[model samples]
Target: MTSAASPHLTGGPETLVICGRVDADRAELTPRGELVHGCADILARALAGLPATVARVDLDMAGVHFMDTAGLQFLDVLADHGRRRSLTVTATNWNGQPRRILELAGLDTTDPLTGLAVTDPLAAAPPTAPASSAVALERAECLHVLQEEVEQLRQAIASRPVIDQARGILMATHGCTSDEAWHILRETSQLSNTKLRDVAAAVTASAEADGPPPSPELRTALHRAVARRRRGTGKAT
Candidate 1:
């Protein structure tokens, strides 16, 4: 027997509508509409509604036409939900604007949710080189790029929880939106010449009891980043 949820939106002109069904140990969620602010909470609630028997969750993202940077939080919600329950969560059928958004975010566009690249669309294209050696070299370069991307995806997946935690801390402490928090973190990382994950970890640690705050350099960088955001937007950040 299969159980399904009623189709509904989170209530906005550009909102996400979630509808899905569960069968045995697998739950399939089909989300349509724009993935924007408040979308993550809606996704979290939908995941909570699933039965304990579900060990895997798959999202069909074909209908999802648009996604902003905040959409990453929607993915984070799925990841956090899966991690807490030891479930396998995957979002597939990504294309168009959402896929482009994933690419811009340095995520795996082919399979963003799992951070897995299922296919190499570039490999199928014939090499334009006239010489066999040149073709081989071109292929090798492509292979190298693919390997780099795979490694990046692995690192991104591993760092996601800490980064999300850091973003939440920034949002709460600074009274900023998720997008603003992300920009702050990124700007801090670049300005301080530090890795983004390291910056995130520092932010997370600073919020915890008895945990050390960010170092002087990072602290200065963060302040500058927040200031820049506020000045650029002409609003609180």
Candidate 2:
């Protein structure tokens, strides 16, 4: 039998969809869509919605074209569920950007739920000696840095569409080139002491008929940015 789970997120409609089919004692799950912020929760719900008779779960991730760091959490959800329910969970058939993301996050691309890097035989070997306090501290710091990088990447991916829209708006309104639009947005963001993505979102939203205008600070900064660009290019503002 096939099953699906749907969950609501704050900002937008759900992007991930989990479809499952059950065999004798195993369930095959295929998740298709962009795995963004709340997708891990959806995966959890999907696992919980599985039939009680399912003793094993295999996820085929080929259809998942895009995934951010939340994909790691999705694997965690499956692993946690499998442990709690005494079920075997294996994820495979990962390809494209999702697979590359898995590699970047240092996960087992073949079967991340097992937390074993199958490609490297030495990774499974026991540690030769306990890590010293200094070494442990360094490792922890490295992990913190890695987490920050992953979060930055995720935010960039999430913000790209809005940023592009903002750039397009500026291009159309001012008859500026795309690079000039980007420069204006960046300058305005810096001048207004705001995030580039936030500035882009404000610019995009203000262009809509019913959307709220940007804050006064953003407006002033944006004006100055455009005026400066006009002066630099020897064009009328």
TM-score of every prediction relative to native: 0.47, 0.53
RMSD of 1: 14.5
Q: Estimate, for each residue in 90-157, the C-alpha lDDT of model 2 and write its tens digit.
A: 98988987777777656678877666323244653546555456555754564565567667877998
Please report, in order, the local distance difference test score of every candidate based on alpha carbons: 0.80, 0.80
Clashes of 2: 0
Report how far off residue 53 is in candidate 2 (Å).
1.5
Instruction: In angstroms, give how far residue 165 of model 2 lies from its true place.
Output: 11
Query: Model 2 misses residue 140 by how many Å?
Result: 5.3
Task: State the TM-score for model 2.
Answer: 0.53
Model 2 has an lDDT value of 0.80
lDDT by residue (tens digit), candidate 1, 1-237: 454544443436657878878888999998889887788888888888888899999999998987665577888888777766878888888888678667756577766765532234464354665666776675456445544655676699899999999999999988889999999999999999999999999999999999998999999999999999888878754
